[model samples]
Structure formats: C-alpha cells, structure tokens
Target: MLFLLSPAKSLDYETPVPAEVPATIPHFEAPRGPSTELIRLLREKSPQQIATLMHLSDNLSALNVARYKAWSGRSTPENARQAAFAFDGDVYGGLDARSFTPAQLDWAQAHVCILSGLYGVLRPLDLLQPYRLEMGTALANRHGKDLYAFWGSRIADHLNERLAADRTPVVVNLASQEYFRAVDRKALKARVVECVFEEWKTDRYKIVSFHAKRARGLLARWAVLHKAATPRALEKFDLEGYGFDAEASAPERLVFRRKT
Candidate 1:
C-alpha cells in the first residue's frame, strides 16, 4: 500500500538533517521539468504581484520572492533538504521525521508520497528547495488556468506507476481536498481508501482540521514503525488515543475517532 500526503506551507531549513540520511532529487526536477516552467513564470512576478496572487502580507511575499530568486535546480546539501524533514507544519510535527532512523526513513521513502504544487509528487527523501506555491493558487500556466490543470492526470499516472509493483496495490489518501484535487482519479489504477480522523466536539464527532492533519502523520509514522503493508494492518492504528470506528468506516473510507 502507498500512502499519500500533502505538502506543508511552513518549512524548517535551519534544523540540520543527520549526515547519514541520504537524499535524492525529485522525480520531476530535471533541466526542463514542470517546475522549471513554473519558476520561470514566478520569476516574472514582483513582490506586490505575489502578495496579491497568493494573499500574503508584504513581508511573506518578499520572503517567497527571495526564495524564488535564490532557487536552483541543483540539489546540494546547502541548497536543499529532504522533503519529509524540511516541512514543518502540523502534519509534519506529528510525522517527526527528525527522530526517524535511517532504516525507517528508507522504508518511508518507498511507501510514502507527498503531493506538491511546484514539484508534483515527492518521496520521503526527495531533495526540496524553499518555495511557497499552494495547489489552489490561480497561477496560470501552459496547461490551464490553475495548478490543478497544470498537474492534470500526471500525478495520478505517476502514482499508478509506483503502485504497479505493490502486492496489494492500494492508495491510502491522507491529503487535503485541495492537494488531492490535482490527482485525476480516472487515471489512477489503484484502489483508493481515504482515512478520516475525527474528534469529539460539543455534541458529536467532528473533523477538526488541526487534529485531523496531525493524525494523518501519526498514521504514516505508525505504518512506518510497524511496517504495515496491507490496508487491514492500518485498522490497528491506535496512536494518540484514536480508535478505528468500524461503524463509520466503509471499504473506501476508513474513519478513526478520539474522545479528545
């Protein structure tokens, strides 16, 4: 089974990745790759244009502008870090890749894939440069009006290729709707199973964004630690007080709930 995740806006390049943790270039980071074209378009935009386009403050827009300007296709230790270690958001906080052993990271590299607006799909150890582009961004490209159009069926096709070698050939979707939309479901060949994490609200169970995001990472971490290769093994997830809700779960949708 392959695990799907979304990229985080928050990043952490300051934290030093262990020297033993090896890194690889992104699958689509070639000389004339899709990212190169997007960077070329982004380079044309001024800080003010970026501010308006991405709905950012003046400071954040300037920061991203600098990142774009300094961006290089080369993947060196100084310019880039592993994707899993670089992302420092809620989901990543739960993933805690910094604590993972090199062996565990190797396993995650094979099973986990992160969807990105700029770099299509990324494995755990894929080298990542600093940039801020959400999949929902309306930056028009050669493909169409939005990033979704830009990705089209490419993401799904790539996932299919990765899944072809798996015994079960299943995709566990832990991504948000925005990023997942980039994937053309019609083009994907694997069975997709979405995992929903909910917490008890005032009256009943509800999906709180923060808890849900963290839970997704927690699930991935649990899978990595346990080497869970089958969908059935995922049902055993009980991290952070969560329990599988058999009543709310279906074959395509697995629901996990927590009292807190």
Candidate 2:
C-alpha cells in the first residue's frame, strides 16, 4: 500500500523542491568504540575471551531466542560472507523482539518500519543480512507495502542531496558498488522528484538535484525541472530522454555524462 499525503495548496506543479539544505553535514556524535572499562578488559583478555563475551551477549540477550538461533544456524561462516552479514545486521537487520496485542503490533508497523526504522538511518546494504525472523515478521505484517515505499523515498531524498547542485558539487564517492545498485535507478529518480516536491510543500527552498548516469560517458545535468500533481511545477526526472545516460550509483544517484 502506498502512503498518501495531500499536495501543498500553493504548489503549481511546475516548480517544487524542499528548502535546500546546507551543503555541509552537521556535526554528529563521536564514532563508536569500546568504553574505557571494555578497553581495559580487552587488554587483560585473549581473543577467545573477547569473542566468548561477544557471543554470549549476542546469544543470551536477544529478543527471540529460537528465531535468532535459527537464523544464525549451528555455526557462522567466519569469512567475507559472515562479516558482510554482520555489518548489514548492525543497523537495519537484527533482533528486536516485543510482545504486543494485534492493535499494538499494527501501530508498530509504521513506527518500527523496515525492521525498526533501520533502513532510514542505515545504508541500503544494511538490510541485506540475516535478521531476526520475529522482528522482520512484525515489520512485514505491519507495513504491507508502505515499508518498501518509505524505504525507497528515504533513498530518493539522499539522491536529491547528491544531485542538488553543480554536476561536481562536492565529490564522487561510492563506498561500495552495492550502494549504487541498492535501488532501481529509474524508479528511484522518479521517487526523488516526488519526495522533494512533497517536502517542498512546507519548506521554502528553491533549487534541488536529481542525479543520473548511464554507460562510461554521459551528460550530468541538473536543470530546474517540473513535477506533476504536487505543489511545485518545476520538478524534473527525465535523465535518459534528455540525452544524459543515467546509471544509478550510491544511494541510486543518477550519474551525468562524463566531462570531455
């Protein structure tokens, strides 16, 4: 089921975009690391001891014991696959058990969307891991189709940021090939237009970006385009038809025609 909201009353469907956000990212908290006590303890313990504690914490403190165990199986692969899965599970896929009545569970569907809003806060590949079945089941039951839509919209917003300015506004960085392939390129571009115009309903920003790239070389353009039905009129999402070969990269951004 698609989530629906009324378009802004003033949008002409010709020019729409969320108030542009500052190019600079706001400062965030310090990165994660062992606490002082944990660091001390690690110094005193061996690798086996450290792994034992970690395993115990994860194994014993989980929400659904049976489901978590089943998902993990008798043993872990202990290689690239295992590490990749572990990283993915850390944010978007993992156990978060809870007991609630049918109504409560239904509400959680939206609140705990995509295995607990992990997809929103985390990278896309983070969802492609071994998740606790109990938690995933809850999310799927609650959202139906809204979860996927919400997830798509989130990525689309990110794409807007990457494409909102000059063809080479900041940098061309892709943490992983998986990131670029995270979503359907064409559909994601379309969704970016929808999300930007939707947010524009309130915020008073002007210009925005719509990224696209295809093949080795293509036009990387960001013109003030038009949207449909939404409040703004100048919302554009047609990369290929405009002579720009579009290939979705990290967060599914559309790459531009390479420079000569």
CA lDDT, every model vs. true structure: 0.92, 0.24
List where candidate 2 sits over 4 angstroms from the true fold. 1-138, 141-147, 168-184, 187-260
Model 1 over residues 1-260: C-alpha lDDT tens digits?
Answer: 88999999999998888899999999888778888878888999999999999999999999999999998877778899999999999999878888888889999999999999999999989999999999999999888999999899999999999988877689999999999888899998889999999999989999999999999999999999999988888999999999999999999999999996
The best candidate in terms of TM-score: 1
Please report, as a residue range, the 10-residue window in candidate 1 with the lowest summed lDDT: 70-79
In the range 46-67, model 2's lDDT, one tens digit per residue, is 4444335334344333422332
Per-candidate TM-score against the hidden true structure: 0.98, 0.22
TM-score, model 2 to reference: 0.22
Which RMSD values do the candidates have, in order?
A: 0.9, 20.4
lDDT of 2 at 181: 29
CA lDDT of 50 in candidate 2?
33
